[model samples]
Target: MNTTKRPIVTGIDGSGEALDAVRWAGRAARLRDVPLEIVHALDFPALLAGGVVPPPEEMKDTLRAHGQRYLRAAQEIAEAQGTTAVTTRLDPDRAAQALIEASRTAALVVVGSGGRGRLTGLLAGSVASAVGAHAACDVVVVRGDSWDDPEVADRPVVAGIDGSEPSARILAAAVAEARARKTRLVVVHASADEPRPETEPHLDPQAATEAGEQLLGELTGEHEAGGITVERVVVRGHPRRELIERSATAQLVVLGDRGRGGFPGLLLGSTGQALLHNAACPVYLVRTVS
Candidate 1:
C-alpha cells in the first residue's frame, strides 16, 4: 500500500467521546490533505448469547440501524472539523478486530477514551488499548478535557523518550505535531529515582541526571527545525508519572511503544496503563521499531 494514499481512520460507538476522536481525526486528515474514515462497529459476537449465528433478522437490522445513525453523526462531526474528503464504514467484526484490520492500510487509528452503551465497545478503553497494541499504524487514544479547555489550545506537544527505544521517529513525529499546532515542543527524559544503568556499577545520582540531560539535548537538537521552539526537560520522577502530569498542560502527548524507565511498554504491556487512562490530552503512540 502506498503510504501517502492511506486514510486517517477513527472508530465510534455512539458516544460523545468517540465524536471527540472524530473531530480530532478530521482536523488531522485535513491538515495532511488525506481522507478521513469514520467507522462504527456492530459487535455481533456479544449478541450470540442465544447460541445462534446472528441472533435474528430483526436484531441484526436494529443493530445496523444504530450503527448507521452513529456513523451519520460521526460524518457530520468530521466534516465540521474541516475534513474535505470523508468516508464511513459499518463493520460487523468486533471493535478491536475491525480497527486493527482497518489499521493495515491506515496512516493512523483513533478511538475514544471510553464508551457508555451496550454493544458499543468501539469507544471503550479496552478497545483503544487493544488497537494501540496491535494496530499496524500509530494509534491515538482520545482522552482528557484538553479539547474542551480553552487554555489548552496553546499548550506544547510533549515527547517522552527513555533512550531505550529509537528516539528518532518519536522525536520527528513530535516535531511535526508541534509545528502543525504552532506550539512549542517539550522533550522529556524522566527518571523516577535517578536510577543508573545496570551495566554501570559506579554511576551516581548526579551522574545519572547529567547523562539523562545530555541524552535529551543530543537527541532533540537535530529535531529542532521548522522554527518551532524546542525545550528539554530532565526531571526526577517516574517517566509515566511525569509524562502524565505534563500531559495536563499539553495538547498532545507522544510516546514510543516500548522502552524502559516509566515507559517500559505502552500498549504492548500494562506498564503504561495509568498514563493512558489518566492522560490530560490526546496520547499519540508510535512503534519505535517497525
Candidate 2:
C-alpha cells in the first residue's frame, strides 16, 4: 500500500450519478493503493424550505441516515475492490463549499456531472465545476453512460503541454499514471495563429513541428529517465478545441491550471477552464504551487 496521508475524496448525494462517482473513486483508490473518503454534503435548510417541511431534529436524523446509506454503498464498492474506504457527513449549508473544503486533504476530489435536481447536465454540473475551479488538488467530473467503456481500462493517458513550468508537473503526473497503468502516454501541444491574407508566407510548418518536438523531447526525456513511455503530438488550432477533440478518445486528460503566459504562475488559466467545461473524458488539473 502507498500509505499516503491524504485519501481521495468523492462526493455523494444519493443520486445515481453520485453512485457512479463512488464506483470510479473506489477503482482509483484501489489502483493508487490509497485510502478513499466518501463525502455527502447536505443543505438542510434548503431541503426543509424547499417544500418538505420537517422538524429540525427529524431533518437532522433524516440527513444522517441518508448520508450513512450513501457511505455504505461506497464502502461496499471499495470492499469489493479491496481498498480502504471511510465516510464523512458534512452540513456546510452549501454543497460546493463543503466539497472544496474536504478537498484540502484529498489527493483527488471526485464528483458526478449531474444529480437528482433541475440543474442537471448544465455544463459539467455546478458542484463539479465549482470544485474544479477552486480545489487545491485535482478534481474529476464523471459524466455519461460511457463510464462503463472497457477502453477506460486500456486507453492512453493524454496530457496537454505548452512548454510551461507547470507543465513539468503535469507531464510528470501523466507519466506516473501511464507507468502505473502500463499504458501509453500522449503529450499534445496546440499552437495556432491567425492565418495571414494574400501570398504571405505561412508560419513554417517545419519550424512549428521542430519546436513542438523539442519541447516534447524534454518532457519525454524526463519521464523516460524514470522509465515511462510517451508519444508526442502537435496540433494547430484553438487549444481548448484541439484538446477536447483529442479527449473524446482518451482515457484521461491531464492539464495544468496555468502556463507560461504573462501570469503563467497563476493557479487557474483560461485554457484550463475551457477544457474543464468541454473535455469528454475525465479531466485532471495539476496545480503548480509557488
Candidate 3:
C-alpha cells in the first residue's frame, strides 16, 4: 500500500502524564511498525522593557540540559516498551506550535491529557487541545489513570460515527488501531430524533435504527473481511454524552475532528471537544485532508 514512512511523534515535559503519553506513543509506533519521536519544547517567555533581549547563555543552557534529561527518560520508556526505532528532539518553540509542525509529516501526534505550565489543565492540557484541533494528521490525547498501562491494550477500540463525510476516515483509523492491538472494535452511533416539518411524514424509530445498523456494517465491511470483530451500537440520545459514557471502559475513543452536527464555521466541533474534555480514555481525533 501507501508506504510513506511517517513516525509517531509524542510531546513530553518530564511529568508523569507526559511520560504516559510517551509510553502510549511507543506502543502505537511498535504496533504500526514505525519509528517514534519524543519531543520536548523549551518554551520560556521573557519580559522586556520596550526592547527584546535573548535569555543569557547560562539560562538557555540550563533549559536545554533539562530538556535533554526529559528526552532521555522518554527514550528509555519507549525502548522499554520494545520500540527500538526511537529518536528525540529538543524544540526551542511553543509546545503546541512545535507539535503542530511535527504533525506535518507524522503518522500520528500524541500528547498527555495534562502537562506542566501552559500544558496543564483538567480534561486536556492547553497544548494538547490546540495541537489536536490544528494538527494536519491524527492527534491522540492520552487521558485517564490507566493510560500508561500497557495491559490496557486488550480493551475494545471505540469509534463514534454519524454517517457523515468523515465517518469513513474515522472508522478506518479505529479499525486499524483495533487491528494493531488485536482487540475488538466497538462502533457507536448516537441517533437523536430531529424535528421534521409539519407537512412531513413522521419517521419510524425502528427504521432509523435499521438504517444505522446497515451503515455501520457497510462502513466496517472491509475490516470485517480481515477477521476483525466489530460490534455496532445505535442508541437514541446525545452523541457526545453517549460517547463519553462509552469511553469509560474503552481502550481508546476515536472521532472525527468535526461531525455532521458540528458548526460548519468552527474548526473543532462541540462533540469532539466534549469527548476530548470528559472521556475517561484517550481520545483520537481523525481529520480528513480537505
TM-score-wise, the better of 1 and 3 is: 3
Full-model lDDT for every candidate? 0.81, 0.74, 0.85
* Candidate 2 CA-lDDT value: 0.74
Candidate 2 residue 77 C-alpha distance from true site, Å: 2.2
- TM-score result, candidate 2: 0.85
lDDT, model 2, position 61: 81
Q: Residue-pair clashes per candidate, as listed?
A: 1, 0, 0
lDDT of 1 by residue, 121-234 (tens): 342377877887888988888888756567876889999887775777888888988888788999998855335667857655688689889888888877676689999988
For candidate 3, what is the TM-score? Answer: 0.91
Task: Kindly report which residue stretches of model 1 are placed more than 4 angstroms away from their true locations once superposed.
Answer: 1-4, 49-52, 117-124, 193-202, 261-271
lDDT per residue, candidate 2, 198-231, as tens digits? 6755567778778888888876885765665678
Error in Å for residue 32 of model 3: 0.7
| Residues 17-90 of candidate 3: C-alpha lDDT, one tens digit per residue | 89889988988887888889899998755322244777777888999999999999899999998897898999
Give the candidates in order of lDDT, highest first: 3, 1, 2
**Which candidate should be chosen as best, given TM-score against the real structure?**
3
